[model samples]
Target: MKQICVFILVLMLTSCEYFNVKKTSSEAILNEELQTFNWNDVDVYPTFSVCDSNETKNEKTACFTQVLTTHILGYLQNKSIVVTHDVTDTISLKFQVSETGMLSLLNIEADSLIIKEIPHVKELIYCSLDSLPKVFPAIKRGQQVKTEFELPIIIHAN
Candidate 1:
């Protein structure tokens, strides 16, 4: 009788899910009902620059800074606000872009970690988007053609 009573108690304490198996797939969640970038229409263009000076006194360097800044901050202003877990106005990142216009993710170079005393609080970090290399167009009959654009963003949460 004691054994039967223990079994009954256990059964009563167990929730309906305790004995059931779940059948959800990660792929289904990855492709969650959302639209993604239209990679097919993306363009890549190179900015011309003089290799000697840190300051861009030439046309190419100026153009590079302009485009790079737009791509980097544009996403942050639109996306960072909705990062949900992000409490700060900006998300910091550590990244490197190859000389050939390929963007690489380095790390989240941040000094301050999240504080638990305040809920949803975040900190700002630095990213090298400002120094991203310019991709020059290919020369065809003394002309150039635009090709592609690539940028990577990194974030860390505590």
Candidate 2:
């Protein structure tokens, strides 16, 4: 009876041991990393050289927008787009700032008539946007990340 009890105890202990766990593949790792992260809100807003000194988040954002607007407006002053028809609309520009403080144009929203009237308007807008000064990207959880913004360009013609 003692030998039978000892054998049962050893069997239970051996059975409880875990074997080699299933190894994950590279594809599995990639898929696991494909989880989406929330980019709509960030802990730190993007900052410019002049705006970095601001103490509050709202202040910094306001300064950043002001500086960017000034830069784009300055660039646009040198270029002109003609509107053949009487129209009043806003051109929405979507852009992304890279993690390394570089700007890139993503999409532009404009009336088809505007595009037909001024075919090169897209190029002109891009040139203006590209000329903006470098700015630090937004940060979240101590890591720098790309940020997106939608800016509108109002067009009122008579």
Candidate 3:
């Protein structure tokens, strides 16, 4: 019977593995998602009360940077730093903002010449960061997350 043969062929094709929908386990799905997720990128950057919260990502970043730079420069400028030699170097300052909005200095990288010229530079930077205003932690997936920043501070002293 032609109808019976057609039904048999259809049944055979449906029974093949290629036609079956595979079900993935939740754990496997989660693993895949984690693999594809970008850990370095955050949905929202950390902000200060002075920064506009509704700004775009780039604007938020700029606001944060400007605020931080202003505060640090202001603090440093208040102190009279006298250097014997004309020194021009960049200091790398690595710091972190905790999930609870606490700022902590991780490390400071400065050239030997700069360090020799300004022996108390590290202490000044530490004190400056300690006096920073309240910071808001970065947001990732609507959750507060800790973030690290490395800012280069150029020192030009004659």
Looking at model 1, which ten-residue stretch has the lowest summed lDDT?
117-126
Candidate 3: tens digits of C-alpha lDDT, residues 5-108: 99999999878967778999999999999999999999988889888765699888889888988888789889999988999899998989999999888999
How displaced is residue 34 in candidate 1, in Å? 54
- Which regions in candidate 1 have their CA more than 4 angstroms from the true location? 1-57, 80-95, 111-134, 137-158
The candidate 2 region of ten consecutive residues with least summed lDDT is: 30-39
- 2 or 3, which is superior by lDDT? 3
Determine which window of 10 residues in candidate 3 has minimal summed lDDT: 46-55
lDDT of 2 by residue, 1-158 (tens): 99999999999889776664788999988777656556578888888888878998889888977887677657756676566777676788787888998877799899887777767777877787765777899898799999999877765554
RMSD over all Cα atoms, model 2: 4.9
RMSD of each: 22.4, 4.9, 2.6
lDDT of 2 at 6: 100
Compute the lDDT of residue 1 as modeled in candidate 1. Answer: 100
State in Å the error of residue 92, model 3.
0.5
Q: How does candidate 1 score on lDDT?
A: 0.44
